[model samples]
Target: MIFVRLCLNTIVRRWNSTELTKVQMPAIMHLTRLGYTYAVKFHDNQAGEDYVPDTNILIKIFKEQFERLNPDKKDTFNQVLKDIKMELDNDDLGRSFYNRLVSVSPSRLIDFEHPNNNVFHCTAEFTCKRDEDEFRPDITLFVNGLPLTFIEVKKPNNNGGMLAESNRMNNQRFPNKKFRRFINITQLMIFSNNMEYDSEGGIIPIQGVFYCTGSKSKSSFNCFREENKGGEKVAPYNAEYSYKSIDSLVEKRVLTDFNC
Candidate 1:
């Protein structure tokens, strides 16, 4: 957890972003009309009142992208979300979702990259619920009010392995489950520890083939093995995997439509 925090803080200090600690998911769900306006229909626990927005800002972005992805079809936020969910529901076409996500134009990132852009928000130990059950990831990243990446941190040595733990979190733990509505909208999935790291979703695989939903661990996961395959030393897909701390890796670049 410390290592991940170090990386996050490094990026936060270097880039035009803000990191919030001791924040609840409800607070993060609603945007205060600063850098980005998500306008999500968040259940307001603040002031013990109810607040519902008419449109989801992130979903609106998706709707625009979907319209661009299919110019012939008329797009609505609900239909756009349902279409992505349909592709997401299919195990074989998981990478299609990643392709579409990355294909989103940089303009849609929403006033990012400026000195006061403030589109990216990072929080530690945020609680999210799937129906009545709740889980807290080590870190949750929000881009323009969209909770895009979820990071699960662990100790050096735990259960089966980092891969096993990541698989459990990615596929079993409220994720890919109907009740966990939040996970359905999430694009990037990551798991890390001091000794090992793995990331999936959001970005396409270097090998050019993404993992099937049913085959989560097979081709999708990229680990920092650095082993020699066929007498050639293999490197992690993204150089950031090898980097202890870098501004462009997970934070600045992933949020933008740079196609890294």
Candidate 2:
């Protein structure tokens, strides 16, 4: 599978274009190329909750992976989802959730030992609502139906650009208590306007794409850089991966348009 961050570097090279073509759609397609399935938006309705982790998909995938990972404990399969849901819901700052995600302490939510044994999905326009407040991220990446990270793409050269999006997330989004669970569930948040980073020594991120873990802090936002074997800065590869009938899939599914 292609590394997601490395694929995200494609945005910088095409920053001057529209949001969908330049960053959002390409990001989704890249993930699909990297073995992530493109989950249709309507399926998000099956989430059946105002909040996230998409319980419908979560339970289904968990059941499958749990059986696969814990073959000897097949009879205990029914309890694992409940345990995971309880742990995820009660998590503080996603610390517990993160632990479960990377390790198998609470339960084997993911099969880190066998990469191909897991399910990877990328969905667009995932909605999360709590009370009167709501958040609809541009794209969300799911592993075994657990929403671990989400991406927000801004129009290139929009007013205030990536900086403005950053402020909105920090000042408006993060401050809302309703989204606390959303924040807890999402381990990473990425914002991009397709602009290149300021190598001219800007102390803070003023352009390009930036990311933060769980939640944001005053100076927590960071950008990605690729280095070669010799440790010299290099550009990201704008490569394509040909899956079976990918051209047909891309053409038929308007959502996966590869005009980029």
Query: How much lDDT does each candidate structure score?
Result: 0.43, 0.67
Quote each prediction's TM-score: 0.41, 0.75
Residue by residue across 108-186, what tens digits does model 2's lDDT show? Answer: 7688788888888777777777667887888988887777888998776668867777777878777666676678778
RMSD of each: 12.8, 9.0
Superposed model 1: Cα runs more than 4 Å off: 1-118, 174-176, 196-220, 224-260
What 10-residue stretch in candidate 1 is worst by lDDT?
Answer: 47-56
Error of 2 at 18 (Å): 2.8
Q: What is the C-alpha local distance difference test score of candidate 1?
A: 0.43
- Report the poorest 10 consecutive residues by lDDT, candidate 2: 48-57
